[model samples]
Each structure stands twice: as structure tokens, then as C-alpha cells.
Target: MGRHSRKGPKSSGPDIEAATADAGADREAVRPVPGTGRRRRSVEAPAGSDGHTPFQQTGHVRGGHPEQREPGGGWGTGLQQLHRGDDHRPGARPTAQQQAAAGRQQSTGTRPLVPGPRREFVDAFDAPPAPPAPPAPRGPSIPPPRPADPSTSVGERDEQPPGGGTDGPAPAKDGKGAKGRTFTGIAAAAVTTVLAVVVAGQVTQDNGGGTTSAQPSGVDRLGPDGASRSDDRPTPEPVRAKPLSYAQKMAKAYPLAPELKASGKFEAVPGTAKAPGRGHRYRYRIDVEKGLGLDAALFARAVQETLNDDRSWAHDGAMTFERVSTDDPDFVITLASPGTTGEWCMKSGLDTTEDNVSCDSAATERVMINAYRWAQGSSTFGPDKLFAYRQMLINHEVGHRLGHDHVSCGTRGALAPVMQQQTKSLNIDGIKCRPNAWVYPPS
Candidate 1:
């Protein structure tokens, strides 16, 4: 339909071999511009009875005329479906990229032309880059696999770093070990301290670079391997305790002290030969709380002079101790008051109201201490170093009533570690000791 007739030139009337056999006698019929009646039609690229040239039957043209040969590298099926729509028909005339894809389908009106996004076979310049995801299968283990002894202390080396550092040991992780259990239940609750949170509940000291301070008493607290005293001098840096407590950290559970007492009945304290025959003798008891003004016989004579003294927790002879009032005592050192030390240290699962902190329960053998860290003692025993914060609160709640477990003073200024938490910060983990209440102090 090459619109032409101003009613005249198609050779002056019509029938040029019936309009060239209705415009398809293999197309090419266009001879009308002599006066301007116009006619231009085209078609060609046909000849394949083996006379070649559909770009010489696909091997890149040789003897001309497949659209004058020249496009041999990309695209072909004879130049995509033979030059698709040489000017697309049915009243054509659009391009300028189909009037910008018709002004984005008339500003996205029912939206449908989309078709352009396919390119990423590795953005094909010849394609081939996509093969790297296969490495995860090692199994069979326990808590011994990571031990080249860089001072092995895990549970993120009891984490108190910054100013009270402990270097970095954290690798013993199992189900949820550390204060909770499982790297062989934190090495079997680090040798007996399976889980006890408020036997006294709290205290602190950090010097590596953070804040919190307070550090006193060293004139003699025990452990030159196990115990022997003559007030061996040099123990002087005393007087820093109390500072840390910006407060506000609660929630894991709190509230207690509806009333309590008993720093009376439990007595007898005398025994030790350092591992004497070696380890296990337990039995204990001591109380206080009735409104907590403190001093139940100076907190039962600083826990019978820090457990018959061989540097406490019966160090060496494997263990031993005895001080009873018999509520079936194997442990019970009470002294409550930060709200009954969060009610007898949440019966051992341990929780909040940290009035400075102290907790121990190995299932309620009860150690709950905190009358605010047995009356003003932490900042890592800094102030009156209440005889080394009552020998680091009776060797950290009798090393969690003998089952043990919290350690980390393996290095820094050394010492500090009657199961380190040194009341709260002692480089919690970045490693930085020195105020140790024994586990082996003296030296």
C-alpha cells in the first residue's frame, strides 16, 4: 500500500500486469517517480537453490548481494528473521526507539514493553565464570582441640579487659558453656564451680584503661603454694576499693530479703597442712542479714580466718574445711542484704539486685554474701581491703562451694584468680591481674 495515485500516474490508469500481480511478483516493483506519484517497494535476499549468498549460506558472504555482505560476526539467521520489519508495517512511522517506547507506554499506563534485561552469563564476552561454593565438613571433638597453651582460659577468658585485662582465651564453647555449661560443662564447672551466682554476688577493679577502681589489702592473704605467714612485707599497694557502680544493669531476675539472721551457732575453724594427705573435706555454715548493718562476729571472723588459712578453699591437701550450725551444711555462708542477696541468690540459678554482688549456690548450699560485697569491699579489694575482700569472698564463694571454675589471671600482673571475676572487672578478659585473693597467691 505505498500510497501514490493523485488519480493519475500508475502509467496513467491502473493494471500494470494487475498492479504487478497484486504487489508480490517477488516484490521489487517501483517505477513511479517520473512525475512524483511515488512508489518504492523492495524484498530481495532470496537465491538458495545452492547458488549461495544467504551470506554465502551462513559462512560469511563471498560473492556479494546478501544485503551487500559485511555483517558476519554477531547476529544471523540471515540478520535476524531477515531484517525484521524493514520499517514495521500497518501504518508504520514510529522509531526514535519507537517514540521512546511510546513515552514509556504512555507513562506506564498498563505497562507492557519490558523486554531488554537478559545479559549475564557472566556478562558474556565469551562466558565461563561461576564456580566457587563447596567447603564445610570437619567433625569429631570435645574441649581439648584448641590448646597450644597461650594460657588456656576461655569463656572469652572471663571477659573483663580494657584496664583489667586477661589477654584472650575464648574458644571453649559448647552448647552454652562458661557460666552456663558444656565444653565438658566448662571443664566440669572448672573443677567444681558448676554454677553458683550470688554466694556473695559482686565487686570490681580495672586498670588497663577503662575506669572502675578500688584495691586494698595484701599484707597477707595466703597461698605461697599453700600457706605460711609472718606478715611477709611488700604487700602494700592497698586502699582503692569502692568507686565503680554507675549502676543500672539489672534484669535476669531480682528482689529479696524479706528478713533473715544467724551469725551465731556455726563455729569451729582450724585445719590445714596444704593438700595434707590431699583434697576433699568440705562442711560449712555462717549467717547474718537481720537488716544488715553487718559484722556478724566480723563476718564470722572473716570466714574463720579465711578458711583455716592454708590459703583458704583448703588449697592443696586437695581440700578440707569444717564450720557448722548444721542445716545439713556442706555450704551456707549467708550475709544477704542487697535484698536478701536477690533472695538467697535466686536459689542458685542466680539473678539481679546486684548490691555490689556475691552469689553461690551449687543448688542452694547457699553462699549469697553481698551485704554490698560484705560491707564495702570490691573495686577489687581497694579500700580497707577488708582483709583482701574477705579473701576474695572466701575464695570466690568457696570456689563455688568446691566444684570450682572461674579462673583468668593467668598472666598480666598475675595473681588474681580465686576463680577470677574479682568482684566484677579485672580486665574481665583483656587480661590484667594483681589483686588476687589466692588460689595460689603468696608468690
Candidate 2:
């Protein structure tokens, strides 16, 4: 190539001849630099045929000349080719020559000095349609099922039977196996139900009712011999007799032989009864002979209660009687057998053997009351008036000890005095006085 002149063009004929001569001179002046062995050329931005500078064509200043340039003009063409695809036509394959040239360009680190044939532009719509993509390969079809092996166990088998089917030999269509299992299960359940019912019934019977009775903890459920005592029936409570009332006790009569003699030894009745009134108090002791087989306590209580009665010697608060167990007393009221009474009465110079009567043994500190008379009512005051007769006996004997003498009723049907010896004759001299127990009987 020849270097173009930077001067303005002159007349056409002369300019052509001068340019030819300058081209020849430039060719001669071009020489290789020492050591590089390559021609060094000064590149200038010459005006193009269109009258545009190289800078105007490429939008950049051109320095020294490159070894080659694209024929169409500026270095911009070389840059475009470097970036452009090797195959200019769509869907066109690269030729062997183009491939070899690309390989050399890559090796030599340079662009092709000579451009290839000019690429003709083709419209995308006018180009041939791409071959339809081959249909996707069809998926492998399912294989046929194989028969199951009898020798293999269910777990070791390659494929399991559907619906978790059993591998064992199927039961016979006769239904014997199913029927036998169902019958066995039914029998077991029935037996269990019967056993539960039987146990409940036994427990109910043992407990005697639906509710169990709690046993007393102190009571031993087992016998001394280590045998289980029968608890099927509740033990019956022991029967206890009701106690006798005071009226019933006073109404009852006690038995004693009129002539029976008892041991003369005496035992002082124990315990004291306080005088219940603020009056002239008289203290007495009650002594019961041994072997009397009498209720000494009852006798002593009767003596104290009767003597302190409002209607007796204690009437109008004239006196109150207190029973004492001490030796010192106003008098000793003695309850003895008829014989003992007779012996004690004799000491006072009185004879009670004939009537088995009670007397105040003044010679001694004892007022003897015949146990026979104390136990049996007198004929004058018969069994119907036995309670009153017993009271009269106590008052009479005690009255005598109080220095009272026998007195008879002056009027018939009038009550006899407590000191009237009512036990012997309430109807003295045919006056027929009603029997009385109180010294001051109720009007």
C-alpha cells in the first residue's frame, strides 16, 4: 500500500500525476527499522473520498499506521470483524479454510489482513424454518406381572401381594377354620361373664346384703383355734333385762320365816344420807344381822327416806333424820330375824315373840325391827297395804325410840297414829281405824 498525501487536492489531471509520483517516492522511502525487521510507517488522518477525516470515520484519532486495515476504510471495520461471528449467514456452518484462518489468527495474535467476501444480509423471516425437534423419546412401557414363587417367604418375595394379602394357603371354602375360631372366642367370653356373675353373687351372700356391714375392730373375726368364724350372718346383740322402777320395788314383798333365827352378828350399812331439812336433826345407824339374806341397802335407804319424810316424825320441820355409819348415833335401827328380834326385844323387857313384832330395845341403842315383819305385812295391814305397812313398821319402832308411846284412834274410820302399834292392831278396841304410815297423814 502507498501512503496518501496530506495536501489539498489540486487540478484533477495534475493531481493524478503528482499522486502517482508521490506514491513511488513513498514506496522507496519505506524501510524496516533495525532489529525489528518490520517496516515502520507514519499514519496520517487523510481525508476520505467522502471528504471526512479518519477521526470523523472512526470517532477516534488514528496514531501510527497499523500493519493492515480493513479495505472499507477506518479501523472501526477491523474492530467490527473481530466481534462479528465467523459465519455471517444464519444456520450456516464454517468452512475448513475459515476455521484454519481463525486458528492462525488466534495463534499469531492478529486479525486477518484480508477480509473475506462481503456478507449479504438476509431477512430473518425469509430464512428457512428450523427442522421440527425430533419427538421426545417415548417412555419404556410397563412389563407384565410374573407368577409368585411358593418357595419364597412373604418378606423375601420381590413383590408383595396387593391389599396385604396373606401368603399362607387360603382356608377351605367349607368355613370350618373360621367357625372353630369364632366358637372358641364366644365360649371364652361366656365363661368369663359367668365367672364374674358367680363371684358377685357369692360376695353379696357373704356380706348378707348389697352393702357390707363393718365389723367392730375390737372383735376377733377368727376363732381361738384359728378357724374363720361365720360372718355370713351378723351376730345377734345380747338381750338385757330392764331395771325395776322404784314403785315396783316398793310394791313387791320379800319372803322370811317368822320363826327363823339368823346369825346375830351385825354389819353396819355403808354410806350416809344427809338430813334434807333445816330442822332438829336426829342421826341413826342401820345394822343388818349377817345371814339375813336381805337387801340391807334397800332397808337402810327406806329407813332414811321414811324418817325424813314430810309426813313422818319430820313433819312441819319438827325434825330431820340422817343415817350414819359411825358408832355414835341417836339410835341404831336393827333389822333382824324374828328370833334375833325376840332376843334383842327381851333386853328392853318387851316380848315380840308372840306377834313377831318389832320394838325399841331401849336398854340397848338398837331399835329392833323383825325381819319377818319387815319382809311380810301384818294381818291388820294385809298385802294390799304392804308398802304402807312397811313404812308404819319403821316409824313405829323409831317413834318408840323417840320416846313415843302407843296410841289408838279415838274415832272409827280415822287414820291411826304412826305410834299406834299399827302392825299389831289398827282396829284396837273395835274402833276400826284406818291404817296410816305417816305421823301426820294427809288430811
Q: Using lDDT, give the best candidate's number.
A: 2
Model 1: runs farther than 4 Å from truth?
1-280, 285-312, 321-325, 328-331, 339-368, 371-412, 417-438, 441-443
Q: Write the per-residue lDDT of candidate 2 for residues 1-443, one digit (tens) a residue.
A: 22322233222333334433543543421111011112222222335666543221111112222212112221212212322323211211122233233334444555345433234323444678999999866732333456664533343243233212232222333467557656766776776787788889888978676666667988767756776687556889899999887556666788888889998999999999999988899988999999988889888878888888898888889989888899899889999999998998998899999877888999999999899888878888888878888888898888888889988889999988888877778678878888889988888
Report the Cα RMSD per candidate. Answer: 36.7, 35.0
Worst 10 contiguous positions by lDDT, candidate 2: 29-38
- TM-score of candidate 1 versus the correct structure, residues matched by position: 0.19
Candidate 1 lDDT over residue span 303-405, tens digit each: 6656766766665666666566656766677776666567666776678454347778667666777765555566665764555666677778767766677
* Predicted structure 2: clash tally: 0
**Best candidate, TM-score-wise?**
2
Q: For each candidate, what is the lDDT?
A: 0.46, 0.65
Cα distance off (Å), candidate 2, residue 249? 1.7
User: What TM-score would each prediction reach against the true structure?
Assistant: 0.19, 0.48
